[model samples]
Target: MAGVAGNQPLYICRNCKNPIALRSDLLSKAFIGKYGPAYMFSHAMNIIAGQKEDRKLITGAYSVADIYCCNCGEILGWKYLRAYEMQQKSKEGKFIIETAKIAKEY
Candidate 1:
Protein backbone atom coordinates (compact mmCIF):
# COMPACT_ATOMS: atom_id res chain seq x y z
CA MET A 1 0.00 0.00 0.00
CA ALA A 2 1.11 3.55 -0.68
CA GLY A 3 1.65 6.06 2.09
CA VAL A 4 -1.21 8.53 2.41
CA ALA A 5 -0.65 11.87 4.09
CA GLY A 6 -2.48 12.40 7.36
CA ASN A 7 -4.58 15.25 5.97
CA GLN A 8 -6.03 13.27 3.08
CA PRO A 9 -9.24 11.39 3.63
CA LEU A 10 -9.60 7.91 2.16
CA TYR A 11 -11.98 5.03 1.84
CA ILE A 12 -11.27 1.79 3.61
CA CYS A 13 -12.63 -1.71 3.48
CA ARG A 14 -15.58 -1.98 5.85
CA ASN A 15 -14.65 -5.49 6.88
CA CYS A 16 -10.97 -5.05 7.60
CA LYS A 17 -10.25 -1.34 7.44
CA ASN A 18 -7.71 -1.84 4.71
CA PRO A 19 -6.93 1.30 2.74
CA ILE A 20 -8.78 0.92 -0.54
CA ALA A 21 -8.87 4.23 -2.35
CA LEU A 22 -8.32 7.89 -1.79
CA ARG A 23 -11.28 10.23 -1.49
CA SER A 24 -9.81 12.46 -4.16
CA ASP A 25 -10.07 9.69 -6.68
CA LEU A 26 -13.83 9.47 -6.35
CA LEU A 27 -15.65 10.44 -9.54
CA SER A 28 -19.36 9.90 -8.82
CA LYS A 29 -21.66 8.62 -6.10
CA ALA A 30 -24.77 8.34 -8.23
CA PHE A 31 -24.28 4.76 -9.22
CA ILE A 32 -26.13 1.56 -8.26
CA GLY A 33 -24.62 -1.86 -7.69
CA LYS A 34 -25.92 -5.38 -7.22
CA TYR A 35 -26.56 -4.63 -3.57
CA GLY A 36 -27.32 -0.93 -3.52
CA PRO A 37 -25.73 2.50 -3.80
CA ALA A 38 -22.16 2.58 -5.08
CA TYR A 39 -19.40 5.00 -5.90
CA MET A 40 -17.33 5.35 -9.03
CA PHE A 41 -13.64 5.95 -8.61
CA SER A 42 -10.87 6.75 -11.09
CA HIS A 43 -8.52 4.49 -9.20
CA ALA A 44 -8.58 1.87 -6.46
CA MET A 45 -5.86 0.15 -4.42
CA ASN A 46 -5.50 -2.83 -2.08
CA ILE A 47 -7.90 -4.82 -4.18
CA ILE A 48 -7.98 -7.88 -6.39
CA ALA A 49 -9.86 -8.06 -9.66
CA GLY A 50 -11.61 -11.31 -10.36
CA GLN A 51 -12.28 -12.89 -13.74
CA LYS A 52 -13.72 -10.65 -16.43
CA GLU A 53 -17.27 -11.41 -17.44
CA ASP A 54 -19.97 -9.78 -19.52
CA ARG A 55 -22.90 -8.36 -17.63
CA LYS A 56 -26.03 -6.48 -18.63
CA LEU A 57 -26.45 -3.56 -16.29
CA ILE A 58 -28.85 -0.59 -16.26
CA THR A 59 -26.49 1.50 -18.30
CA GLY A 60 -25.52 -1.13 -20.87
CA ALA A 61 -23.59 -4.30 -21.49
CA TYR A 62 -20.10 -4.25 -20.06
CA SER A 63 -17.20 -6.55 -19.42
CA VAL A 64 -16.46 -6.29 -15.72
CA ALA A 65 -14.41 -8.00 -13.08
CA ASP A 66 -15.50 -8.33 -9.48
CA ILE A 67 -13.18 -6.52 -7.10
CA TYR A 68 -12.26 -7.91 -3.70
CA CYS A 69 -10.52 -6.52 -0.67
CA CYS A 70 -6.97 -7.85 -0.60
CA ASN A 71 -6.92 -8.13 3.17
CA CYS A 72 -10.22 -9.80 3.92
CA GLY A 73 -11.16 -11.10 0.50
CA GLU A 74 -14.59 -9.55 0.79
CA ILE A 75 -16.37 -8.54 -2.37
CA LEU A 76 -16.27 -4.77 -2.65
CA GLY A 77 -17.71 -4.20 -6.13
CA TRP A 78 -16.29 -4.40 -9.63
CA LYS A 79 -13.91 -2.92 -12.14
CA TYR A 80 -14.96 -1.95 -15.64
CA LEU A 81 -12.91 -4.08 -17.96
CA ARG A 82 -14.61 -3.16 -21.22
CA ALA A 83 -17.55 -1.15 -22.42
CA TYR A 84 -19.47 -2.45 -25.38
CA GLU A 85 -20.90 0.92 -26.36
CA MET A 86 -18.67 3.69 -27.53
CA GLN A 87 -20.58 6.15 -25.39
CA GLN A 88 -19.73 4.16 -22.27
CA LYS A 89 -16.11 3.64 -23.19
CA SER A 90 -15.04 6.32 -20.77
CA LYS A 91 -16.03 4.03 -17.91
CA GLU A 92 -13.50 1.50 -18.96
CA GLY A 93 -10.74 1.03 -16.38
CA LYS A 94 -12.82 2.74 -13.70
CA PHE A 95 -13.94 1.12 -10.48
CA ILE A 96 -17.40 0.83 -8.94
CA ILE A 97 -17.31 0.05 -5.24
CA GLU A 98 -20.50 -0.59 -3.31
CA THR A 99 -21.09 1.80 -0.44
CA ALA A 100 -21.92 -1.08 1.88
CA LYS A 101 -18.45 -2.45 1.46
CA ILE A 102 -16.45 0.58 2.46
CA ALA A 103 -16.15 3.38 4.98
CA LYS A 104 -14.72 6.88 4.79
CA GLU A 105 -11.71 7.79 6.90
CA TYR A 106 -10.72 11.26 7.90
Candidate 2:
Protein backbone atom coordinates (compact mmCIF):
# COMPACT_ATOMS: atom_id res chain seq x y z
CA MET A 1 0.00 0.00 0.00
CA ALA A 2 1.15 3.52 -0.71
CA GLY A 3 1.00 6.32 1.82
CA VAL A 4 -0.41 9.78 1.27
CA ALA A 5 0.21 12.97 3.24
CA GLY A 6 -1.23 11.48 6.41
CA ASN A 7 -0.41 7.80 5.92
CA GLN A 8 -3.59 6.94 4.06
CA PRO A 9 -3.48 5.05 0.78
CA LEU A 10 -5.99 6.52 -1.64
CA TYR A 11 -7.28 6.05 -5.13
CA ILE A 12 -7.40 9.29 -7.06
CA CYS A 13 -8.54 10.24 -10.51
CA ARG A 14 -5.69 10.08 -12.98
CA ASN A 15 -6.57 13.37 -14.59
CA CYS A 16 -6.79 15.29 -11.32
CA LYS A 17 -6.14 15.26 -7.58
CA ASN A 18 -9.71 14.24 -6.81
CA PRO A 19 -9.74 11.42 -4.31
CA ILE A 20 -12.04 8.57 -5.32
CA ALA A 21 -11.53 5.88 -2.75
CA LEU A 22 -9.43 4.50 0.05
CA ARG A 23 -7.20 1.57 -0.92
CA SER A 24 -8.30 -0.41 2.10
CA ASP A 25 -11.91 -0.48 1.00
CA LEU A 26 -11.46 -1.29 -2.67
CA LEU A 27 -12.37 -4.66 -4.11
CA SER A 28 -10.14 -6.30 -6.71
CA LYS A 29 -12.53 -6.42 -9.66
CA ALA A 30 -16.09 -6.03 -10.90
CA PHE A 31 -17.96 -6.90 -14.10
CA ILE A 32 -20.34 -4.45 -15.73
CA GLY A 33 -21.99 -5.55 -19.00
CA LYS A 34 -20.74 -3.69 -22.05
CA TYR A 35 -18.49 -1.53 -19.89
CA GLY A 36 -16.44 -4.64 -19.07
CA PRO A 37 -13.97 -4.84 -16.17
CA ALA A 38 -13.72 -2.32 -13.33
CA TYR A 39 -12.41 -2.13 -9.81
CA MET A 40 -15.04 -2.47 -7.14
CA PHE A 41 -15.24 -0.15 -4.18
CA SER A 42 -17.55 -0.31 -1.20
CA HIS A 43 -17.48 3.46 -1.01
CA ALA A 44 -15.98 6.25 -3.09
CA MET A 45 -15.65 9.86 -2.02
CA ASN A 46 -15.64 13.15 -3.93
CA ILE A 47 -17.61 11.87 -6.86
CA ILE A 48 -20.74 12.95 -8.70
CA ALA A 49 -23.22 10.72 -10.46
CA GLY A 50 -25.71 11.41 -13.15
CA GLN A 51 -29.26 10.07 -12.90
CA LYS A 52 -29.30 6.31 -12.49
CA GLU A 53 -30.25 4.46 -15.61
CA ASP A 54 -31.74 1.03 -15.16
CA ARG A 55 -30.76 -1.73 -17.48
CA LYS A 56 -30.41 -5.46 -17.66
CA LEU A 57 -27.18 -7.11 -18.71
CA ILE A 58 -25.96 -10.63 -19.43
CA THR A 59 -23.89 -10.66 -16.28
CA GLY A 60 -26.81 -9.57 -14.10
CA ALA A 61 -29.38 -6.77 -13.79
CA TYR A 62 -28.72 -3.39 -12.25
CA SER A 63 -29.59 0.25 -12.08
CA VAL A 64 -26.38 2.19 -12.56
CA ALA A 65 -25.41 5.73 -11.79
CA ASP A 66 -22.83 7.15 -14.16
CA ILE A 67 -20.33 8.46 -11.68
CA TYR A 68 -17.69 11.10 -12.28
CA CYS A 69 -15.02 13.08 -10.51
CA CYS A 70 -16.44 16.02 -8.61
CA ASN A 71 -13.29 18.10 -9.13
CA CYS A 72 -12.69 17.66 -12.85
CA GLY A 73 -15.89 16.08 -14.15
CA GLU A 74 -14.04 13.08 -15.49
CA ILE A 75 -15.89 9.83 -15.98
CA LEU A 76 -14.88 7.58 -13.13
CA GLY A 77 -17.26 4.63 -13.10
CA TRP A 78 -20.71 3.52 -11.94
CA LYS A 79 -22.63 2.99 -8.78
CA TYR A 80 -24.97 0.03 -9.25
CA LEU A 81 -27.76 -1.73 -7.46
CA ARG A 82 -29.70 -4.87 -8.23
CA ALA A 83 -32.85 -3.38 -9.69
CA TYR A 84 -34.69 -6.65 -9.48
CA GLU A 85 -34.79 -9.18 -6.73
CA MET A 86 -32.29 -11.97 -7.15
CA GLN A 87 -32.26 -15.38 -5.58
CA GLN A 88 -28.60 -15.01 -4.74
CA LYS A 89 -27.41 -11.46 -4.93
CA SER A 90 -24.00 -10.69 -3.52
CA LYS A 91 -22.97 -7.14 -4.23
CA GLU A 92 -26.39 -5.59 -4.10
CA GLY A 93 -25.20 -2.00 -4.16
CA LYS A 94 -21.67 -0.73 -4.72
CA PHE A 95 -19.48 1.61 -6.69
CA ILE A 96 -17.46 0.30 -9.59
CA ILE A 97 -14.34 2.31 -10.36
CA GLU A 98 -12.93 2.10 -13.82
CA THR A 99 -9.29 1.08 -13.43
CA ALA A 100 -7.99 3.25 -16.25
CA LYS A 101 -9.47 6.39 -14.77
CA ILE A 102 -7.70 6.13 -11.45
CA ALA A 103 -4.22 5.95 -9.97
CA LYS A 104 -2.80 5.09 -6.61
CA GLU A 105 -2.13 8.30 -4.70
CA TYR A 106 0.62 8.40 -2.20
Find the candidate with the highest lDDT and give its number.
Answer: 1
| Runs with alpha carbons beyond 4 Å of true place in candidate 1 | none
Summarize candidate 2's per-residue lDDT along 9-43 as a digit string, tens digits: 89899998777898887876655424556787888
Positional deviation of residue 1's Cα in model 1 after best superposition, in angstroms: 9.5
- lDDT (CA) per prediction: 0.95, 0.76
C-alpha positional error of residue 90 in candidate 1 after TM-score superposition, expressed in Å: 0.7
lDDT of 2 at 41: 86
Model 2: lDDT of residue 79: 80
Best by TM-score: 1
lDDT tens readout by residue for model 1, 1-106: 3366367889999999999999999999999999999999999999999999999999999999999999999999999999999999999999999999999988
